[model samples]
Target: MFAIVFILLLFSTGDSILIGKIQNSTIIDVTHISLFNITLNQCICKLITVSGIIPAANYFPGNQSCQLFNFNNNSSLISSNFNTYWIFTNQSSAFITNTSITSTSSPTTSISSSSTTTSTTTSSTTSLSTTSTSTTTSSSTTTTTGCTNLGMFPYQSTYSVGVSPQSVAVVDVNSDNKPDIIVANFGSNTVGVLLNVGNGTFLSQTNYSVGSAPESVAVVDVNSDNKPDIIVANTLSTNVGVLLNTGNGIFRNQTTYAVGTQPWSVTVSDVNNDNKPDIIVANFGSNTVSVLLNAGNGTFLTQTTYTVGTSPMSVAVVDVNSDNKPDIIVANSLSNNVGVLLNTGSGTFLGQVTYITGTNPKSVGIVDVNNDTKPDIIVANYANTISVLLNRGNGTFLNATTYLIGLSPLSVAVVDVNSDNYPDITVANSLSNAVGVLLNT
Candidate 1:
């Protein structure tokens, strides 16, 4: 019953779908996810679908242990070490004997419904080739949320994207609650949209042509529609392009707004409190930042430019001074520092003040580090370090406390990794080719 065995591995919720469960093994909690339950599929499905996380749920029928695993990117599935082998027991009998095997969903999906003995004579094994499964359907479906955890693990998969993909933003494009990916494909001169199809896989990437060499992408409802739209900083085109989400995952053609030279990054915020989203872009070549106030109906006035440090490559919006209004933060790469431009009333900003970072800062993020209501700054420096600059009450910041993390800290984000309520720092190390997570104490 390879056909029947394959149908029981799928896990699905409202819109959140697990990639697939690891074969027919009971979940061994190797990831130390202290989920105590006598029922098998209910606990794993609830843990995966309701948890908003895609942690690897490995199945080990023996002892009913659930496992969590980590795999590197661009690798194949390794089973003997990782324990993801499959087994298709003869299901003609009502009960399984000798071995430990568990399942999350009902197995009636692929079984014969005509007669009681009809499935009893079915062949139970198929050619699942090299991997350790006795006989399994390779591409079949079942109600499963278990992710593959071998090389990059099979579940944390990679989509063949356009060449030289740059900045990426995640949002639910379709009405489904599943998150989708929007990436700026710089080398291919387009934007790639990969939508989740509730199976472990995604629909083929839908690529939309935009301005030349799009470097960064952001999502916002620019036209006041609830549907989110795509915006990209076209570096070579020296402009910003907007792709309105017509409905579903579809988008209209590129509508261009000229900006400074080489707009490397872009972000959106309501700068004037007009309830409409505005665009902020970092012009790398021009050494300035442009604020495009959303005029009406997805259009912007001539950009209002503000001077910043040399080669401002990244832009972010945060209330850095506790002023309730959104302020701007830019990483001036050539200047090796970050510039903070405080917001004045009515879409205007004062002069930018400089704070030193490591050599060549590339990205910046805002988070409340010490539970101090005031937002602090976390910067990713290209020189193999992360700089944490704490806020000092008013609109200023203290000298940064730096940490050596990896080869090249290219990107940074803040999240509470261990559910400890304290924020943690994660970095994408470009040179070392790793992701480092520093937990908060």
Candidate 2:
């Protein structure tokens, strides 16, 4: 009697050539393997034992059914194989096997392979179980090497929001520990809040009317009530609207505060260090930024307007001069440059220091890109490039270095996505409908 023994192997990143691909060919055999109800490792191990050939397959846990399409030798999932994974909306997944048994010995030879698949809820680690059957050789199993079998989609769900949402903010409006989605619907002139009900699903959106053509939205705990409130930049109405969260994701009627003409963006921060959040708006039409100081109870004490370059589309509040005082960084759309307004003290900003950027600069982002402890500036220019200006610690910036990304970059964001400790850049290219990422080495 011949006993089949499976030997598992591990491949490193350099051994990618050994991985297999499913070839497109005429179907030769259609086999359904559903009898083995076991772990993913044992399932694929047994699968190769029976078929001796890899095939295109689909598996679902809902019915515990798996269909394998076998074409031929050339029809093998790959020229000759590792493991291939296919992801679906189904809870379970299917695999395309690519292992070749070069030669088979008689009764005592080990004939097995190990595969690791990851699931959303749980990840099972596989160990190489090399069962030796030779009488001269003592039977041994390597039980310590764990392979991460990854099958993840914790929240592979999607929900519908309103049409033409210009901007969004995520906050725990209902204090559920789950962040909910809030959007400014530019088309409908309303701010929509979709409360999270845990596990990636959100309740129906509740919309509150703001000003006409609301372009941006920000969330902060206004009125010191410890609840997240909503602030929207209504461009057509040339004002900022505040909607107080009346508990449980509900908001009261909006209270409007007049600002510069065509307010395109808004930000919330304690610019004055008063322990209260203030509202800042970028008025595109007037080439000005409005700073509304927070009076007691989330109310504003009128806005103080600051002169910047023409067509200031976006504004960022950060200490550009390393003085610990929050300054203002504005991306001037018409002037094709970025201007830094250093805060003198107590929310008073001095004249702007201009730094040239690419044509039609649209947005500003502050990041310490070079690990220099000083915050750097990133500008998104509509002329198909993004400009980086290194800060010189004292208000001024070095020359701009432009990186060609794609068509019409309208917004820029900086983050350390790959854990390399170096900051990376993400740009939203409006002309291409795709986002471009620039990773730092």
Candidate 3:
């Protein structure tokens, strides 16, 4: 009977492969994703194949209800819960039943065949373990299984990444629809560049060696030549390096100029209010931020140096404390604060605001974490937690929520993982070896 159910489900999608389904939250392994269909609204979907079987259809009933279904080997219908009870059914018998419990439930089911189908679910902001599935079969035998969820009240879930990654700056030097990743390795002396392979996966193209170390990297048309250029802050080098992107990944005419001691971060902004992008370098070795006026050519002239706080590691240009012009926010790593530099609208700094944050900060990124119109600050700290600072738009940060994440997070990159119109965080944990992803609710 299980063999028949497996064959039917596998044949339903016109694929001859085994498929598996998750009842409630229980995960089963399938060999392929070709056998099941997935349908969901507002909830994220994840598909895993096990033992040569694919996953069954995933249906999101609504914001408050979710059901994972699959047919068992005995042609029984299986159901798992989002809020209440759990039950497993074969065409003729009940295998497992937990009626007294009242919580979200999950079950797993599987079958064997050949061929494949693909489907996806919407991403949520809740925490869920990563699911894996695989399937295997022999020439003479077949197997089928089912999982079910039976529950009461179901609510939409919010998913968070394991480590919050922010500070993603995309640029296509090759005119590809995809963007390349220029990561500023703060502690490491190299800048990691990952090329987009048109597909969803990113390939590490090359790592450029910069002096001392790099904190942040920005790509822009510095010469108005239509091609992008790379700007990196050599923290210990106490200078900024410009590498003009040469159609290929190789950079030429590498130029280095003094800005300040321990230049920790850099940003390209139109400081003169003339629409021409300018350069701002935050110095950590020195308590100052340097502004360089763009010469229209590929070179820059030092404009002025403004004193900031202690150990500024990150810089951002935003119109906070709005006065029609953009302001500068520097994440002071050692000071445990973010320094806001109010713009004078005339290429000068007027005043500054200091917002207290968590300890031993490494990097910072801005996003609308609470769905508010104003941007919030997500700080990745070496202290092992992420600090979410709500921007008041008046140069002040409201109460911050620090989320405990991976160990020794060095940087952050924010992107939409499931295309939910909301942003998620990805963290590059230096010591952890693997990148951690956090989905925002």
Which numbered prediction scores highest in TM-score against the true structure? 2
Q: Give the TM-score of candidate 2.
A: 0.71
Residue 128's lDDT in candidate 1? 27
Q: TM-score ranking from best to worst?
A: 2, 1, 3
TM-scores, each model vs. reference: 0.71, 0.71, 0.58
Candidate 1: minimum summed lDDT over ten consecutive residues — where? 116-125
lDDT values for all models: 0.73, 0.71, 0.61
> Which scores higher on TM-score, 1 or 2?
2
Query: Where is model 2 more than 4 Å wrong at Cα?
Result: 1-85, 88-158
Candidate 1 lDDT, 252-365, residue by residue in tens? 998999999999999999988898999999999999999999997999988999999999988899888876789999999999899999999689999999999998898898
Candidate 2: tens digits of C-alpha lDDT, residues 171-217: 99888789999999998989899988897688889888889999999
Global lDDT for candidate 2?
0.71
| Residue 63 miss distance in model 2 (angstroms) | 11
Candidate 1 Cα errors over 4 Å, as ranges: 1-22, 25-154
Per-candidate clash tally: 26, 13, 75
Worst 10 residues of 2 by lDDT: 117-126
